[model samples]
Target chain A: MTNAAADTTPAIEAFNLTKVYGSGNTEVVAMKDVSLTVARGEVVALLGPSGAGKSTLLTAIGLINPPTAGRIVIGGQPVMEADHALVDLRAFRRQHLGFIFQKSNLIPFLSAVENVQVALEINDVLPRPARSRAMELLDYLGVADRANNLPDALSGGQQQRVAVARALANEPSLILADEPTAALDSERGRQVMELFRKVAHERGAAVMVVTHDHRSLDVFDRHFEMEDGRLKNGTERNIEQ
Target chain B: MNLATKDIRHNFGRFALTTVGIGLLLMIVMGMGGIYRGLIREATLLVEKIGADLWLVQGSTRGPFAEISRVPANLEDRARAVPGVAGARRFVSHTIQREHRGRPLRMVVQGLSWPEDRGAWIPLVAGRPLRQAHFETIADRSLGLPLGEKLKLGKDVYEVVGLTKGMVGSGGDGLCFFTVSDAVSIQFDVPGEGVRLERQARRARAEGQDIGRLQPLLLERAAGPASGIPALAPPQVSAVMVTLQPGADAAQVAATFATWPDIKVYSTQQQINLLLAGMVDKARRQLGLFRVLLIIISTIIMALIIYTLTLDKIHDIAMLKLMGARNGIIVGLILQQALLIGALGYGLAYWLGTFAFPKFPRLVVIETPDLLSLAAIVLGISVLSSLLGIWKAMSVEPNKVLS
Candidate 1:
């Protein structure tokens, strides 16, 4: 396990995570023996080159793509092993985890605040309370001024910030960020990276971000690298199968 | 629910287009229903107004309304004497065309037995009944007849003494009632001026002893005064109206008359089915075909709308899946929009169907059951049409986001 996650029990843990696409002779391993953990209140960086299977590992950890043969434990509960079984995938995702993507990916129809509120509402929060909570997040992201704006009206940085707020709306324990800064410039990208660090430290959430750019690595509590379907330099993060 | 509302708001133009398409189809469906009901409404007014218990016609034919059938005038006396009989009235029904204010009112003339006879069956709205033996009439308001209005028949002008309501024939022509003798005269009356002119023309030609003068003279000397009046009733008519005495068996009475030679007996139900219930049934069936066609067009239009709307958001759907939104959530959004359009279109259709067209010359009696059942059927089809979008949304893969 990585040192930070190993300091106490991890909020997220993977054991020998592997993903193979297609079957038999035509098969290609998108990820092989990926193992990492991020403890509560820690922010970790996953570094890789283009086509280095960063997305596959993130999808696996996000509980969307079940690993071909591996074990996943989230919040001290066994979730997927060999084949995926994560209680109800929809409920587990809605209640336990958050996700951010390279693009803002906010639903274009919803206003910035409503985009975040939808997450809380879907989890059955009362409307007034959900709206208040969404407003708090918009304020925290420094996008409260544009809270009423639709996605089409917001600047790129503002949209991505709203997406981050949406991911945090349900008070999820683990946040997975896949290339979350790829769409921003160095200054805005560093600001978004620092926000993840602040969220992890202040809210006690475990954050794992996959990125190709190394310019914002200072915001991460720890860093690991992946190459050729495996982690290369991070010995403490190597999975035991 | 939130996603559905959001999607519709974001694509307001698309949703409005869908509603317009559905509205056009709904308009056609409602129109067909109105046309079919109009025909039935008109054709039933006569029989419904008369309120008879049983109908008697020639043994081999159905008549007085549906066809031509005549029997002896003495048969009314015979029919009134049958056991369980209250009274019988002789009614002579035939069509007449006359000019009123330069427009044609094709009327069905009913020759009533007398005031104490079946005259009670017809309601007179104004003025007096036929006081004279002939040439006085009670006309339906559908003929646009006002009090004391005169209709030109050949060379004579007959004054409208009374007005009737809702009396019509199987052909949807309104009815005018007169004394049996009056009806006979109106049916047989030859204009005196025309006869005189013809006689003079024939004499001037001097071809022979003129045929017109010869026939009237020959017809008059050897016969009664009414005999020369071509308007008099024939020795017989088509049918008698039968009213039952208390606790009488209508079925048995009808059965008793069933075996009579050259005559047919019908209970009110048989008469309704053969004569009135099915007046425009074939036409209604055709209008029903048009309704089906309109609904089919609506189904196709709805399918295209939902499909296009789904395609517009292929990226959003993939992103939602990537964000761990359930397939159910995505599907609910599309289906809710479809049901919204259905509810709107049907609401407008029912409102217009019930209230808009009754004032037209043709009556549109939209039955309540038809309105309700059609609404439900249209909504069900709308939901089915919506499933195509839901299915397409469900199949999108989050892996596309990774790519």
Candidate 2:
């Protein structure tokens, strides 16, 4: 999927984003003046070495951590303009964005399908419709067979697939995944990447994932490499599938 | 956070176990509270149930009926003369051991005189009140008296015509209600054979006659209540039961007795205070201490439980924080869980406390206000204990999950 072929809007934008932890001599700059935009229906992979601020940038854009200085726009809406600083971030995140972590992180008590359904439930969705939506997401992710399996009972790759379905449950325009394939093997990692691409292209969700694994580079529509708190395009971005 | 339902379902075992622990602790708190109420009831049981408003007793006596009170029989008449005094009667209570069915039964013989028809105190719970008042007695049900049995007191036998309930004395003795005259006779009536045999033996020693022959003769000579008896008569009575006249206060009427100077006086309330309430004051205090300690132990245990359960969710909580969940949502989740647990514990406490005491060893009184207050107190404790962990969870950072 090409960014130009996608919807006429930016799915996620971060301008002049900076995250500084601590103060004075002990201050650590996690992200410094970082800016990026991913268009709707495009999947972008953030590539970086360890400690290159890949997670910091991802978290800032994900709204888990507000940037110390800068503005963030999600789904073409200026959600963080420094004016709504006191606004509720958790409710905003629940309504507008989704998250996937290295581990499946599905609540251990609920079944694979219920894990996705709960995300919608927390947003005050009616339980009946919530179940229907959860099942649809699970079916789309190609793991409808294991919907009843708990997190511990499912395979690692299957768990990650369910986690992806959970992220897609609310139909958010942007799905932020951090090291989404870190726990999967090369083959399973490719499958998960392809799923994210499908969600980006078919569901019109702009997907961004932080990955250390280079084996799955062919799956992303765009790629940027982060080094020492800054992002620059890699030769891999120009590489054809 | 999408975690409330998940956290609860995810650890069903831990949740059930925690609920059970809270339930047990709640039961203990309820039991202690019930026992305390029971103590209050035990302290006031006999007096409150005796069905009288004023007690006329000898002056300066205030317990073992309200304070230690013993008054002359004439005090009842004098009490009736006082203004606002409608009626007064005499009641003498004395403890005596008698043989019934080859078993020694210790009984308190209560002498009820005219105008003091306290026989109502012993309702025909088993039989009827003493109809004749001369040869019949009414007794508490616990006395183990049959419907028609003779109660042998000294030389004569008093028939049981009625039985009553809830008339326990301060010393836990069963009361036997008899007529005033009957009680007086029993107080002094000597065993017929024993008195005569002693006298005959003494005379034989002094008369130079054969001991067996003299004994028979003396026994024949002393035939009835009229023979060989000094007849000093039984002690009249120790106290009287007085009722205040309509519209007249018993305390004021009792104050009138101060001028009489012949005897001491006690109002009904004073008698209840001295005899029943005062008798059980020590027990009430002991039970009160027990209740306080149990509540402290339960609260501490409940607090530890809620805290431990909260700690078990540390990892999940950290993850929720990392996933863009707010502190308020986290706090609400923990608090909802805590309060629900508290509510369940309180429900169990109320049911067990209110229904469990009557069947207990001693009567336990569970008042409505006490129940309501305890519920509020337990709920407050639950909220307070949960706050400890809520604060800790609030201080938990999202960075903890990322690592």
Candidate 3:
């Protein structure tokens, strides 16, 4: 499902993004004049302390919470400009964006395979193909043997792997994660972070993960650090290993 | 897979138990409707089963079931003499309490005119109709009297020769078919001591008169047994059932009987209307009100259940919303569960009612139209009740999952 347009353009581009909450005396600026770009086939880490505007920036780029002032382009298409949507936000998210939360957030009632299949089904994909594609993604994540198990039955790492498979179900151009491996042990957390790297390079999709763990810094192709509602720096890494 | 069913499978125990609770409520609702239908059925049973075209009752009385009506037993003959009357039968009905097998049994005694009307019109579920005129009787099976059982009343013992199903009187009591003479004897039966006292009173009153001193034989006759009395009229009947000739206008025939000063007249439909309006009007209203209240309660319970189920899935719903799952998907989850609960409950109501209703003290008549109408109402309720859950699900903020 990779598009030719995605190959020729940056996967995500944010220009002068800002987000403010409340108004008057209660007004707080969560993110300020943040700008960044991530190319296809790249994995980037957003590093910050607690309340460092990392989530605000991610949500704005994901089109979940539109910024107070910004322009967002995904796969060479303008999606949102200063909270005014250029395209249907929900539809655009379903077709091109995917998210993974800290808790895995897999629907408890569905099996591991069904969790992935539902993501495709929401996009109106027929069930037969959706299931087949879901199975393939689970196999790629090495959790195919546990595909039929419910979320509660899976190990923390396995559950996060299933969540990753679900995020990759729509072949989205951009995948965002907020502490995707927070619940796992160090070994499992590193494995999950590495899985995002493999997914980004092999599927040619841009991946951004917000994580507090500094132990897996070498897994990313680039790093963006934030402080006091502003992007402090962006640095490229040489990760030949 | 359908998320609603999958979730139900995930929580099968709780969901099954909840469905059963709902099923019981539905059963009670259905039973309320059945009870009202039964009341209507009982009130008009004799009017329809006796196959009468017109009823000749006592003057200005509704009679037999709705009001007290006592006409001369010979009115059957008078009604037969009318031009349009093809047949007329003496009809007497009264409820009696008797002891049988050490249990106080209440039954409605219906007098069937022998020779002319031997209760051939009654539908017997077990055995033959009244074959003997004096003692053989047909009883409703609901009375718990088996075949060949003998019941005593008024110095006579009657044998139960036949059984009818669903036959009841206006008061929800089982009916027993007996000859008119037997029924009248039971109605007027007096203990031996009371009879003796009545005769002694008559003798004393006669002796007190100067005519008694002039004629001693008149005084002796006044003190004799009631059977030897020369001036007593025959027993009175509650009403006379008249059947008209083919193509006879019942209204015209009733108009002719209305002219007589000794009797009142009513067409069969009029008698039925009178029975419904007078005998069971309040009871029907009570059952109808109860049914409406039960339905409202069921709806409220369903709404609360669906709302709670949605609350339990709040986190999952937020996750779905963040995943870009549309509102339709979330709505489907709640709506489908509500409908499933309703359908399963409806099915269980019928399944349980099949055996349970027959055992009720009163008749429970479940009709097809009532079933269909209930199903429609349940469907509407399912949709309406699911709205609360849908509203809550829609208000779920996707950002909550991220936080």
TM-score of chain A of 3: 0.96
Runs off by more than 4 Å, candidate 1: A1-7, A24-26, A235-241, B27-41, B81-84, B94-107, B114-120, B123-131, B161-167, B178-226, B229-236, B245-259, B276-279, B311-331, B359-361, B399-403
Looking at model 1, the pairs that clash are B59-B262, B59-B263, B184-B231, B185-B231, B188-B230, B188-B231
| Docking class of predicted structure 3 | medium
Clashes of 1: 6
Please say which candidate is ahead in TM-score: 1 or 2: 1
Q: Write the per-residue lDDT of candidate 3 for residues B1-403, one digit (tens) a residue.
A: 6999999999888889889988999999999999899989988887898998888888877867777889998899988999889999999899999899899999999999998888888999988888877998999988999999999987899999999988889888999999999999899999988888998998898889998768988888888976676776788899999999998887789889999998888888888888888858889899989988999999999999999999999889988888888999999999999999999999999899998988888888999999999999999999998999999999988887875
| Listed models, DockQ each | 0.41, 0.28, 0.73
Deviation in Å, model 3, residue A169 alpha carbon? 0.8
What is the lDDT, from 0 to 100, of the residue A20 in candidate 1? 91
Best by DockQ: 3
Better of 1 and 2 by lDDT: 1
Better of 2 and 3 by DockQ: 3
TM-score of chain A of 1: 0.92
lDDT of candidate 1 over B103-222, digit per residue (tens): 887998888877545355568888777777666788888889998887777555778888877666766677888777567667766777766665555445433446535666543432
Listed per model in order, the count of residue pairs whose N, CA or C atoms clash below 3 Å is: 6, 22, 0
Candidate 2 TM-score, true structure as reference: 0.79
RMSD of each: 5.3, 6.1, 1.9
